[model samples]
Target: MYVAVKGGERAIDNAHAWLAEERRGDKAVPELSVPQIREQMALAVNRVMAEGSLYDPDLAALAIKQARGDLIEAIFLIRAYRTTLPRFGGSNPIETETMTCDRRVSATFKDAPGGQVLGPTFDYTHRLLDFKLAADGDVDDAPLGTPHPDATPHIMSFLDQEDLIQSEPQGAETPADLTRTPLELPASRALRLQSLTRGDEGFILGMAYSTQRGYARNHAFVAELRIGAVAVEMDIPELGFAIEIGEITVTESETVNQFQGSKTQPPQFTRGYGLVFGMTERKAISMALVDRALRWKELGEDNVGAPAQDEEFVLYHSDNIQATGFLEHIKLPHYVDFQSELELIRKLRREAQENIMQEAAE
Candidate 1:
């Protein structure tokens, strides 16, 4: 016989306390500080910030540690914390041209005006696991190289100067935040790009691969990929003048896709853009490709029912946090709902048995 499970609330609270304690792990060892995590687990922090839509590496690192390395949970924490923050006002559109870049590359041109700076990447590193770091990791304290002042201009801008590529007019109005508002169909460029940045790396990569496999084949060239820190400023109406709020590291990517013009316009090259939190080149690149693929409608191309072209499909499925929550929710207390289904089945079986007996007696 089933008895009522008692003290669920208390059990949950106690379990949470235990989890927090376990996350810290041994009082003598000293708690892992946010700065330590940010410095040590830089990549993990970057991923969390990129997906979380908040670029505070320290906070992201702290959340990661608190969640015991659950990246999605860390993202959730950052998202939740971000909501409590008051919006004073938005700042002028960032001058991306003024960005002091660490890494910049273009696949479109052989050699652009600004030389390609392949700064600090795993591209050249061999995939061999380091066995020396089994006891204590070798910490390198190498100083960084001074950056070139005259970095390369955007490839798209160069193409636009020749009227080969379509030049997008700067949007005067402040774009709506996807986080504040519910997502709707037929999204703007800002909304599309925002969703793609926080999207799961693997999911976006697969979608990009699908495009290459002729799903929605649009000839795309990586116009530019750059990673750097940009100052994030906001206007305070009370002060009546904008002040420097903070700075954040970001990865920006733009792709030029070949397209045959519609009935209205002539054959021209279209563009796709991606701006993400931290130095995540791969995500930014994938985002740009997917963004271009999704723009088939605006560009007057036929919808071939490709995965990337379907906005609903990509936006809804790309986030790991959403997928994971739903998937793992089944492991929670779903027994009550199961009991109802079980009861219904039992009732149906009893009714069927009675009907059979009646028929047999007749």
Candidate 2:
């Protein structure tokens, strides 16, 4: 019998110290400042903010620097920080129609009311490695987009007006925040959409692609993709009304999907929604498809056993923080259990051999 080795706390502390030192790298080289990281590693900061559900670029940059530019680690840091923040109140849902437009585009419609403004996106830029950026080149704003407080309505809204697509009523109730409480089974649309927004981009993309490949393919079309700043209003119960707390930049995607019509119900294009922090169109689009697939139960459609259709699968595996923590946890020590199994196997084999020898002699 092997004695159980039980020193984990000290070892963990040592490991953390070593990791911190490693993150700093060479002592001679000046440490990368948070501002430098915020400026230079803007994409990393953006990704961390997007995934972590926090928009502070400086804090996100600091998290990035501390994590040695490991975006996942940075995301973990930001999420941890976000958890600690005091929620003074909940914001009234931002009206996307009222957003000060930065970028708004639609693939399904050729011409929309707002005229599809493609603002501040790297979508069309060539994927060339710029070596000049390595020397810490300065970036300056090209031309500022004028704020349009009252922009034209969403293109999909026009389709709804014509009765081409299903019109969804905006609920007056506050949506549940997944971060505060344990995610229960049978999540709401708002909860599912929230999880998908912070979910790993690649995982959601793969799930979305799978749907397109005939795994519960619902025939989806991009209705609208909007990126802009929306006023965040918080309801002050004492004051008797909600006030604009602040403004946040967000990207929202609405995908129109084909739904089966019954004898009683008429055929109308159902919609999938995705609203995410920052200008992440790809993630938002993927999220919309996955969101649509998840709505199988609510829409009274047959479940195709798709990855997105499985609530347990989608909710459990979405966050990279949870996924990475569980994945990397396997690296911890498990020698005691392995040794016990090794001893049992050896004992069993020896006893079998002795019994066989005795039987042969008899």
Candidate 2, residue 172: the lDDT equals: 77
lDDT of 2: 0.83
Alpha carbon deviation, residue 314, candidate 1 (Å): 1.4
Put down candidate 2 lDDT per residue, 39-122, tens digits, no spaces: 766666767888898889889988888888889998999999998898776677788888887888888887777677888778
What's the CA error at residue 296 for candidate 2, in Å? 1.5
Q: What's the distance in Å from true for residue 241, model 2?
A: 2.7
Model 1: per-residue Cα lDDT at residue 70: 84
Off by over 4 Å in 1: 1-5, 25-31, 135-143, 235-243, 350-362
Give the alpha-carbon lDDT of every model: 0.83, 0.83
Off by over 4 Å in 2: 1-14, 27-30, 139-149, 351-362
